[model samples]
Target: MGSLSASYFERAQEVIPGGVNSPVRAFKSVGGSPLFIQSAKGAYLKDVDGKEYIDLIGSWGPMLFGQAHPSIENAVRDALSKGFSFGAPSYNEVLIAEKIVSMIPSIEKVRLVNSGTEATMAAIRLARAYTKRDKIIKFEGCYHGHGDSFLIAAGSGVATLGTPDSPGVTVSTAKDTLTAVYNDLSSLRNLFEANPTDISAVILEPVVGNMGLVIPEPGFIEGIQQLCKTYGSLLIFDEVMTGFRLSSSGYQGLTNIQPDLTTLGKIIGGGLPVGAYGGKAEIMNMIAPAGPVYQAGTLSGNPLATSAGLAMLNLISEHPEVYDALNQKGKALAEGIRQQLSELQIDGFVNQIGSMFTLFFTNKAVKNFSDAKTSDTAKFGIYFREMLNQGVYLPPSQFESWFLSAALDEAHIDHILKASRIALEKTLMA
Candidate 1:
C-alpha cells in the first residue's frame, strides 16, 4: 500500500505535467514524489496522507506570519463578502497601493499586477521605455520570474533542473539579457563597458534567495548601483522573496541603496497571487494610461489579494518588533544547525539572514552561483528525505531557500533541530 499523496500524484501525472504545477514541487532534486498538502495552519502542513510536518518553506516566502494567519484570513473573508475580481478600480486597490507606498520608501508610485513575473516583465518594459535602451543585465543566480528575457542564466527551478537557458526564449532575447557574476563588480563593470549605451537596466535580487540564500558581499550592492548610475541604466531590485521578509521596506531599507524600480511579490499579497512594481514617479508615469509602455491585467488588484495584503502590511506596521523576533529565531535555527554539523563532522555551510536560510551540503562559502554549485546535491537529497520522514518539511531543492515563519515557536525550533540531528545521522548512513 502506498501513501495517498503518492496515489494523488500518480493520478495528477496523467493530467498535470510532472504531477505538479511547479517544476521544483515534483521533488526532482530531492528524488521523491512530492507531498500533496491537504491544508496548512500556523507552522504545520497536513499532507494528503494525514502526516503533519513543520513547514520551513512558508509557501516559498509569503507566509511571514504563517499559514492561515487570522488577520490575513479575516481580510480575505471580508473581501469575499464583497466579491472577487472587479476588473475595475476598487477602494481596496487604492488602499493597498497607498499602504505599499507608505511602507517601501523607494516606490513613489506603484502599479499592481497578477504575479511577480508580470511585475518584472512590466518593470523591464518600463525601464526600456524610460531609458530608451534595448539590453539589460542580470546576475547569474538571480531568478526574476519566468519572463522570456529572464530565462537565460536564471536560477530556482531552472538551476535545479540544470537548464540555465530555457527553450522558447529566442536567441535575440538571450543576447539582449547580459549575465553578470553576482558579488563580482569587475564582471559587471566589464559587461557595462562592453554594452555601454545599449544597456537599459540592471535587475537583481539584493539578497538572493534563489541559488540557496546567497548573501551580498560588503559593498557589492553599492558597486552595482554605482555602475548602473555610471552607465545610465535603471536599477531594478527583484524583491519578490526578500520584500517584507527581510524588513518592512525590503532589503533596500536595510542597505539604504535605493533602486530606480523595485519589483515585489509574495508577502505583499499575503500568500495570494499579487505583484507590483514601483519606483520614481517620472519612470512609473510611462506605464500604460499614464504613458507609452503598455501593461494591463483584469485581475491586477483582485479584492481578496488587496485586502489580505493590506491586512498583512498593517500587521507588520503595527508590530515592528516582529523583525527582531524573526531575526532571533533565524539565528537560533542557523546556529543550531551549525552545531549539529560540527558534532556530526559533516562538511556543510549554512547561509542565513532574517528568516531565510539554506544549509548547503558543501564546505565552500556560497557567495554566488559558482560557489552554490559546489554543494553535494546527492547528500542533500538524502538529508531532505530524512527530514521529511522526521516530520520536518524543507525546500525540495538544494538551490532554494527555506523560509521560517513567526508562527514557529521555540518548541517548534527544538523539534526541527532534533529532527535535523536524526536526519543528518541518517544521511551519513545513507
Candidate 2:
C-alpha cells in the first residue's frame, strides 16, 4: 500500500503540474517524490506519513524564530478578527512600512507587494524609470524570483533542473538582461563598459543565498558599489533571502554598503506571502500615486501579513542578541560538518554565513556559480535521502541553501551533526 503522501502526490499530479506548486518542490533534481508536510512547529516538520524531521529549510528563509512562532501566530489571530483584505490602506501596513524603513539602512521609504518576484520586478521597473534605461545586469547564478527577465542564467531550481533559461521568456527580455560571472569584478566591469549608458541597474543577492550561500569576496561588493556609482546605474540589492535572517537590518547593515534600492521578502512576512521594495525617497517618490511609474496590488498590504510581519520585526528589534546566537549556531553546524567531511575523507565544501548554509559535494572552494557546478549532485542526492531517513530535513537540492532558525537548540545542532556524520559515511560508501 502507498503512503498517504504518495497517494496525495498522485492525486495532485492529476490537477497540479508535477504534483507541486513550485519547481523545487517537485524534487526532480533530487530524483524522488517530495514529502508533503502536515504541520511545522519550532525546528521540526511533521510529514503527512506521520514522520517528523528537524527542519533546516525554514520555509525557504522565513520562520526565523521558527515555524508558527507564537508572536507571529498571535498577531495573525488578532488580525483575523479585524479583517482580511481591505483593497485600501490599513494601520498595520503603515506601521510595518515604518518599521522596515527604520530597520533597513538603504530604505528611506518602502512599498509593499505580494511576493519577492513582485518586489524585484517593481524595483527594476523603478530603476529603469528613474535612470531612463532599459538594460539590467544580474549575476549568472543569483535567482531573483521567477520574473521573465530573471530566468536567464538563473540559479536555485533553475540550476538544479539544468535549465538556466526558461522557454516562455521572449528574446527581447533575454537580451535586456546581461549575465555576469559572480564574485568576479572584471566580468561586471566588462559588461558595464560594453553596455555603457544602456544598463539601468545591477540587481543581485548581496550575500547570495540562491547559489548555495556563496559569500562575496573581500572587495567584490565594494567594487560593485564603486562601478554602479561610476556608471550611474542604480544598485539594487535583492535581499529577499538575506534580509532579517542574517542580521536585524539586512546584509547592508553588516556591510555598510548603502544600495540605491533594495528588494526584500522572506523573513519580513513572518512566513506569509509578502514582499517589499524600497530605497531613496527621491526614487521611491516615482511609484504609483506618489509619482508616475505605476504598480498596484489588490492585497498589497493585507492586514494579516502586515500584522505578522510587524510582530516579527518588533521581536527582532527588541532582541538584537538573536543574531549573535544564530551566528554561533551556524558556525557550530558548519564546523561540525567540515570536521565530519575531513574525518570521512569525503570531497565536500561548506559555505555558510550567519543562519544560511550549504554543504556542496565538491572538493573545490565554491566562490561563484562556476565553482558551485563542480559539485557531485548524485552524491548529494544520496546524502539528502540519508539525512531525511535519519530525521533531519535539508534543502533537497545542492544549489539551494539550508536556513537555520533560532528554534534549533543545542541538542538540535548535535542531532544535525550526528545525522550529517552518518549521512556523510553513507554518501561516501554509496
lDDT of 2 by residue, 1-430 (tens): 8889888889999999889999888877777798999999999999998999999999999989989999999999999998888898898899999999989878999999999999999999999999999999999899999999999999998998899899999998899999999999999999999999999999999998787889999999999999999999999999999999888889989986999999999888999999999999999999989999999999899898899899999999988999999999999999999999999899999998999999999999999999999999999999999999999999989999999999999999999999998888998677
Tens digits of per-residue lDDT, candidate 1, 174-263, equal: 889999999999999999999899999999999998899999999999999999989899999999999999999999999878999999
Q: What is the C-alpha local distance difference test score of each model?
A: 0.93, 0.93
- TM-score of candidate 2 against the unseen true structure: 0.99
C-alpha-based local distance difference test score of model 1: 0.93
Error of 2 at 235 (Å): 0.2
Score every model by TM-score. Answer: 0.99, 0.99
Per-residue lDDT, model 1, residue 322, is 91
RMSD of model 1 against the true structure: 0.7
